[model samples]
Target: MLRDKAVTGMQLTLIIAALLILSSIGYAMGRRRAVAAGRGGALRLHSRPSYHGAYVALWCALPSLLLLVLWSIAEPRLAEWLLIARLPDSIRALDPDRLGLLVLDVKNLAVGNIVSREIDPALQAAAEGYNRFLTLSTAAMVVVAISIGVVGAARAIRGVSPAFRARNQVEKVARNIMLAASIIAVLTTVGIVLSLLFEALRFFDQVPFFDFLFGTRWSPQTALRADQVGASGEFGAVPLFAGTLLITVIAMCVATPVGLFSAIYMSEYAGPRFRATAKPMLEILAGVPTVVYGFFAALTVAPFVRGVGESIGLSVASESALAAGGVMGIMIIPFISSLSDDVMNAVPQSLRDGAYALGATKSETIRQVIFPAALPGIVGGMLLAVSRAIGETMIVVMAAGLAANLTANPLEAVTTVTVQIVTLLVGDQEFDSAKTLAAFALGLVLFTATLALNVVALYVVRKYREKYD
Candidate 1:
């Protein structure tokens, strides 16, 4: 085995170095050819020189990498099967779990420092046999892969015929990679959806879906044993949705105007020095941790809200929903301001100039022209803010009462879906119970709601977005 390792070590390293150098040289040569053709002014060429470089790079790198990955997976499995077949009939007859441990020991003995006392003779022999196979197969694979890459690259270079299909071939590879990248995103979203779906199914098996959706009660306790005395678990979730909506409305009220005005001033009113210094400062609002916002809600904002409510002869809970929602609005202000500023800046300066030429004021041009052009981005930013508000957990948990109450009054304490999900999932509970599963259901609802909002925002932005050069 040591002999095999020594024989292959330098060969594999040299092969890898050669592949990199060869691909780089080939791409440079392809570019020179492309530039010569372009300068000759045939004016009927396929693509830019960079496209040719990228084209060769894809062919050179992708196939060999794929082969290496597949071999890495298959070679181990094949080696294990061959070694297992050599094990004595007695060891092979062991239960699967015990046999698995035995196989694990064999693998460790082959590669790791295993003292004789720790290894059985049968396992040590199996390890030796496996190591022999691995070293041999790995060297063969390295040689085969490098040879194929070099040969294919040589063929591509030789075929750099004036009418070479580099452009079409390169575009096709780019399209495939882009398609794969997009599918990865879709697969990620689908995986998230499936996880939520399964958890929701578990919850529904224990608690009726209708009651969870429509019933106003929100407690989630269940008996640890059949003999315990208590009311049956309260599993309704309508109150959570109500609290989420109320807090979101309050946050939107506070954030929309402040964020919009800040954006307008920054984009159209502030001088360059003020804009440069203040823009990043405003964005610092986003940098503040949610935990800091939680304390801000609990310590500062709650007391102030209570005091204001008291002055109006209104009774406010020590942890008012208003405080949490209000601070959340402050947290999201940057979202609206940053996006709206970009959209406003993108609007043609000529439109604003035309308005000024029509004797319109700066305010008039902004209100009539820039704001209209920026409205879609502003709305997209607002939808994102709304999603953030609904998902916020720490601020509401620290400042708002946990009691799940269905009410719209801003001064009243209310619980949100995220807060309830946290409460249910925090303390130790039986994993199989409805109480634990309910968190998953709540999570599914929250995910779906936000996903829907994002889709709608994307649709509106795509359809209504006005482009300017």
Candidate 2:
């Protein structure tokens, strides 16, 4: 059976390779036919030979590929249905659930896997039949796909002529493909939003919407059994919201001034040699994995922060929000600095020259003219950095303890919404339970917050964007 499976796979691969070879042949033939059609003196074709060749090649490959995909999708279900229909009457009389298990056992036996039931003649015969059907289906697929490819190529080659408008047809096909891709992207996003909405609505049915939104406590631990303790869970999300806001604020405070100043220095003050060397090194921070940043926060920064707080007579937890936010800020620095530097560099050189012509120094020109010109992009970068900080999970999980405390103090342990979402959804979870559904509800809220932030950023960009001649 395993050898047969390997042979089947090899056959599919050969079919694909044959189609590619046929497409190449069609391209050459189509180009030659077009050239022959335009051979007379002062003759000109409507489109280039290349377009005609491409048109033929696409026709040769696309229909066959589409058919192969459809066949692959349908083959498994159709085979299973046929196998069930051919099962013995006694087996078919079993309940649906047990019948499903018998079918699974048959498949396992066919694949030489461990099966729940003892082997019998009937099961053995059914497994052999299943394998035979699969082998025949694969053979049929290869034949049909290859035949279609050859016929389509021949038809397309025959259609090639001086006045066929191959370029327009090819471009129309390309445009339709691009439109399909765009629709797919939009539909995927809509599907995600709808899934979240439906699941969150299910969650809201069990928990009051206003309480989930406005209540102060947020312990989402529901009991699995009736006799289990902590059956009633508190669903107030204010503490999670507070922790998210607090950490984001702390991160932005650390990132904004340092990042903006670094951008200014790199763009205006540094010599070309220094800027070129430093810019790539600065951007490398953005590529470092968040988990590494989390490790640094938990092991190095958290202890350092605790020691410093003790020395200064301040109470700091072993896992404080300060450590996580600080590390996250360092991680987000590249996002702001790199983008702001590029935006500042994109400011018109003429504007700088004008400032200098009016007797302004280099620093004054950067401050008064260049900064204003680049303000919109700079703000956009800051917004991106803020989003990155808000969505961060690893740093908070490692350095900041999962204690959802509603406090303004950065020295205390706290947990953010993202951390809770990760916690609630981890491990074996019952999907219908309020505990599991809370993750989707939290996700919906996070999506809404991010969308609102984007809207505000768009407003800021539009309001400050400068137009120059």
Candidate 3:
């Protein structure tokens, strides 16, 4: 048995290297050809020499690149098909799963993997043929792709003339590439949403939709057999969402005033030097990793919060939502402050002068004029901060405890939808089990909630935007 994985990788790398060399040559030759066609007069050329060079390079690289991408995608399936065709009737007669395993075993042997199957004469022959096929395929790809690149470069060089719209052609190709990339992005998002929706629907088949939505209990442990003890599962999401709302509210309570006030002061009161120095220092909070915040919350803030609560004769849980929410609030402060500062600064200075012309004070002018104008942006920043708080998992997992207590009290132990999703999918999971499938259900709910927040944010922004604009 022989493995050609390294050979295939080397072949692809060499092909890319060759393509780059050919494209560079095409670039230099195309520029010289265009210059010659224009009789060496810069004014006689239709487009710049650089544009002509780029046009030729694109032609040389694009078609061959497309071919390489298509071949790479199809190569594995083609190899499997060829392997299946060479296998014996008995191997082909096996069930799909067993046949697939046999094919995998053959591939392992062909790739010099430690195969569990006994080394038989048939496998050795198959490995030899597979290696030969791959070797021939690699050689064929190299010859075909290089030949296409060379022919395309030659044609482009021949087509170079003083009247040729090389820039227009290159720009059009770039535009089409951008359009394709945008379409791919949109299709990928749709694919992900549909995947989640279908899996959630599968989960709802075993668990009642109404029960999962409205039931208070959230135990997802289902009995494997009817006679098994302790097999009842509850799919209620009330506690998870409640805890999420509670923590978000606590976070917002801390973030909104402090962030907005800081923004107001920075934009309206602070000197240029102070704003420059303080703004970056403040925003550096946003750059801190959430895991670092998590450990900080778990080790330091959680204990401090507990000690304070006990001193006040209140029984606070060691892992309280207060600690997580406060730390998360600190993390999101920059999001609100930066955006609000920019928005306030964007409010026309003329509006401030108008308010002052009417004998209004600076504070009055800011409150009456600047604030109204920047209300939409400020609200947008707040909503973004809220969304950040909602999606955070590490801080909650560390400091809020995974108890899923449906309480509004910030001092209590609680968990969120994201924590539950991580919990259910942490280890080796059976997709069919209610426990694992519940993660998708929770994910779907979280997506819906986030979508609702975005919709509300859009509505608020639009409604207030017209008023000021």
lDDT of each: 0.84, 0.92, 0.90
Best by lDDT: 2
lDDT (Cα, 0-100) at 268 in candidate 1:
99
Model 3 lDDT per residue over 9-29, tens place: 778899999999999999999
| TM-score of candidate 3 relative to the true fold | 0.95
Global local distance difference test of model 2: 0.92
**By lDDT: ranked, best first:** 2, 3, 1
lDDT, model 3: 0.90
Show pairs that collide, candidate 1.
none
For model 3, the superposed segments whose C-alpha errors exceed 4 Å read: 1-6, 40-43, 225-229, 466-469
Off by over 4 Å in 2: 1-11, 41-43
Clashing pairs in 3: 219-234
Could you tell me which residue pairs clash in candidate 2?
none
Which 10-residue window in model 2 sums to the lowest lDDT?
1-10
